[model samples]
Target: MKKTITFAMLHFGVAFTITYLLTGSWVLGGAVALIEPAVNTVVFYFHEKAWKRAESKQLPLAA
Candidate 1:
């Protein structure tokens, strides 16, 4: 969770800085900011699902 949030924020900051420099418009920068979190959420969701599936396959035998 923390890793995902950090990754998202880093992406947003870099993108926002670049967009602000190129466009000089906060509104556009704000719009660009939305992309990072959306992408991060999708990535994290899939990552979690994959991890869960892998973990489930590793169960030990019962007595």
Candidate 2:
């Protein structure tokens, strides 16, 4: 989707900017920009799964 692509670009730019600003290395910045999002995606998937499992275990309320 266009929105996803644009947001990904925005995330990459922000990550690269902050890392580069702190470390003064484009290579490290680029690496983190790519790697952090990938790691975050995996983490997010597990986080969602955990949340779903938790929600499913919740008891229903009585009327």
Candidate 3:
């Protein structure tokens, strides 16, 4: 729980900083602040699924 919250804050801080830097509008920055995390969360879900599929296809190495 603590790790999740820490990463959430870290992600938000970095996303907000870059968005504000590029747009110079707090409204736009805030909108991105909300949207980027949601988009990434969905993308990460699919990415992990793909990684699992790839891992399943790999053969075991010799000892």
Candidate 4:
């Protein structure tokens, strides 16, 4: 839990820093920092589902 929290903070800080560097707007940087991760989490749920489906479709090798 502690690791997860720290990683989340690191992610937000990096996101904000990069966005701020590019755009020079605190509002946009903060918004992107918050929104991108939430959206990525949702996208990741479907990404894992797709990966699982693809893995299930693979044929096993015969020894």
Top-scoring candidate (lDDT) = 1
Which ranges in model 4 have alpha carbons more than 4 Å from their true place? 1-10, 61-63
**Could you give candidate 2's per-residue lDDT for residues 1-63 as a string of tens digits?**
454456667778888999999999999999999988666656666776889899999999998
TM-score of each: 0.59, 0.68, 0.67, 0.64
Residue 28 of model 1: what lDDT? 89
- For residues 1-63, could you state the per-residue lDDT of candidate 1 as single tens digits? 786777777878888888989999998888887886678667887898899899989969898
Which residue runs does candidate 1 get wrong by more than 4 Å? 44-63
Writing each residue's lDDT as its tens digit, candidate 3 over 1-63 gives 455455556777778889999989898888887788757756666776889899999999999
TM-score top scorer? 2
* Candidate 4 lDDT over residue span 1-63, tens digit each: 454456567778888999999999999999999988656655666776889899999999998
Which regions of candidate 3 fall more than 4 Å away from where they truly are? 1-8, 60-63
Candidates in order have lDDT scores of 0.82, 0.81, 0.77, 0.80
Alpha carbon lDDT of residue 52, candidate 4? Answer: 84
TM-score of 1: 0.59
What's the lDDT for candidate 2?
A: 0.81
By lDDT, is 1 or 3 better?
A: 1
